[model samples]
Target: PTFGEWVKYGLPFVPVMALVVGLYFYFAFRRRIQVKSLNISTLVRQASRKIGPMTRKEYITAAVLILLIVLWVTCSDRFGMGGPVILCIVLLNIFRILRWQDISKIQWEVVALYASACAMGKGLEATGAALYLADRFVAILPDFMHSGTGLAMATSLFTGIATNFMSDGATVSAIGPITVPMAIISQTSPLMVGLATAFASSFAHMFIIGTPNNAIAYTMAKDPLTGEQLVTLGDFFKHGFCILILSFLVMWLWVFLGYWRWMGFINGSVA
Candidate 1:
């Protein structure tokens, strides 16, 4: 069972992980180089310079990630899985590998955002506000679709809005729990509703501090070809809006068309 679960969740890591393992052994044995400490301050200084941004390997890895993102965005309709999100950590690691000499560039500040977002989201969930809101929304749902697509869409949209102000993981964690029962009560597949929630939450990257992953990436690229670490919240918003819109559309289509029947949302049962 444990192995099966790993197989299920770990499929996304296969190729990239294999390369990482290979690189690890190669450095450990062939280069005879000692593993140094993760030095964030030095890396931060170095990355903020023009020639200090990336190494050859870092450039290659980032290129691969960008290619994968393009492929995933173009092919997600047929692939049925969101590829960019899965590959994000790997892409982030490219910066780590390039700045092996300086660990400070890892940006511990962003980790705080990740932790706090989750905590805030949990606090919201504990307050039962998500449940109360979900219940009210379901009660007022129009006669559009008895299967609860409207409710799911609204839930996802609300979740997205909350994520912009709070943390994406926190938003999902807080409201996601309540959505399950509401979805089931409306005769919607809890799974499809869950997917919508997940996708919408990921759209939180639209803001600078909304998602730590985005913040980390932005910090690392502060001295990109643009030569500055002065990116404001608006700068990120401008870049993220289109992607956010696209993600919502993808979730809506995938749920309503592909997973709707699978989630039993076509049924008229309300319990």
Candidate 2:
């Protein structure tokens, strides 16, 4: 889905998300989480240490980053999602924003891990496991739940659950094609279902293998970016598990409340 559509689609739910954040802070404080285990380190890098007016290099870097985001959002279909990343890297080096030493500092192991995980996800797609899983899911769901609205919720929740085991992008790539047709078969708006599935893909909170960000976070404990422990695997799972449940509820209600239909993302009735 386009960024504009996603922004408009979920804008109404921001208050609910804010309240959830408030509750999180309230509970965390009540539990003394901030006192007991909140480990924060000085994030000062070389550029940040030079507390002065914006430098020309800094402006250039910031501009490049903004352009990178725009390209990623607007040109993803034409260039594929990974294209912007590669282009951004090259541009950064060309402009001296990042040099060979900076590149050398990167943990190649993490890159390898992501590449392998993506390969595995691609294999699942090639083998048609996505379709097989969908068929099995529909077969097991009750007859009544096969309707448009019910199927939307079911597909979303299923997508959310599935995403925790694979990268979010891969999950979307694998399931988007299937859910669109399934939505049509169920007399639902294919666009709505497709959007729901895409959003659900971001619910990959339970496993490091599910997303590159998760994997990188998992490595903070041992990656030497920090001299001490930053996060343990168990800690990641515990916090992420809570976030995952929250996301599932919010997503379900977002659709259940007719937000998609109201926003014109769903054609015809949301029924």
Candidate 3:
């Protein structure tokens, strides 16, 4: 979504998720359970050592990053995804913020993997395999699940499960076919189901290779002191599953309370 569209439909989403996640952290901190084991004060001290004050180069880098974010959010409709990134690269190079050596040090394989995942999502959409599978999947839903609440639950369940098998982008692409028919079946707005599917697709909780974010993080992250893998499959399934459940609950709560309609994501009454 572009800037205006995002303000209209996405503004409500942020606070809801923030509230839920914030409360979770707050209570978890209060319990002091499942929240702490390692002392990160050393790492925090290490990171803050040289970052005491923003130097000229740091100021320039910060400005460039802010500009890049602005261009990304505001001009994405005109420039698409690659333009802002490429422009940011050029700006960074011109400012001596990023050098050719730094660029070359990047793991090209990771970029290739991300690009391939995007291509796979597009290919699935173009070849109609996603549509076919989506159709068959919906056909199997019980008659009782052909209503608004049931369909929302089904969409969340299917999306959460599917995202664990592929990237979030691919899950959304694969869900495109399901949304329209789901709207018809459930007598809700197509936008409602589509947005729900898009939001739900981020619950890629079971596998490190599930989404590009998971893969990139899994590959690049390390335990600061031990140099051990920071995120394992077990961690993904354990903590991530709780996050997925919480997210689903939040989404369901909004749907049940007609918050989606309040946010203009749905029009007319949900039949």
Would you give me the overall lDDT of model 1?
0.62
Extract clashing residue pairs from model 1.
Answer: 39-103, 39-104, 40-103, 40-104, 41-104
- What is the C-alpha lDDT profile of model 2 across 1-271, one tens digit per residue? 5555556666676677658757865785686554665424444554456786788888988988898779866876678657888988898899888999999999998677656656765665578775566566667778755756677777888889899887776677667656765676667777677777877788787788778889887776574665766777776678778878887787766655457666654432443
Displacement of residue 265 (Cα, Å) in model 1 is 5.9
Clashes of each: 5, 0, 0
Q: How big is the positional error of residue 101 in model 3, measured in Å on the Cα after superposition?
A: 2.0
Which is better, 1 or 3, measured by TM-score?
3
Candidate 2 all-Cα RMSD: 5.5
TM-score per candidate: 0.50, 0.67, 0.70
Candidate 2 lowest-lDDT run of ten = 38-47
* Model 3, runs deviating above 4 Å: 25-50, 143-153, 165-191, 206-236, 255-257, 267-271
The better candidate by lDDT, 1 or 2, is: 2
Name the 10 consecutive residues with the lowest summed lDDT in model 1.
1-10
Better of 1 and 3 by lDDT: 3
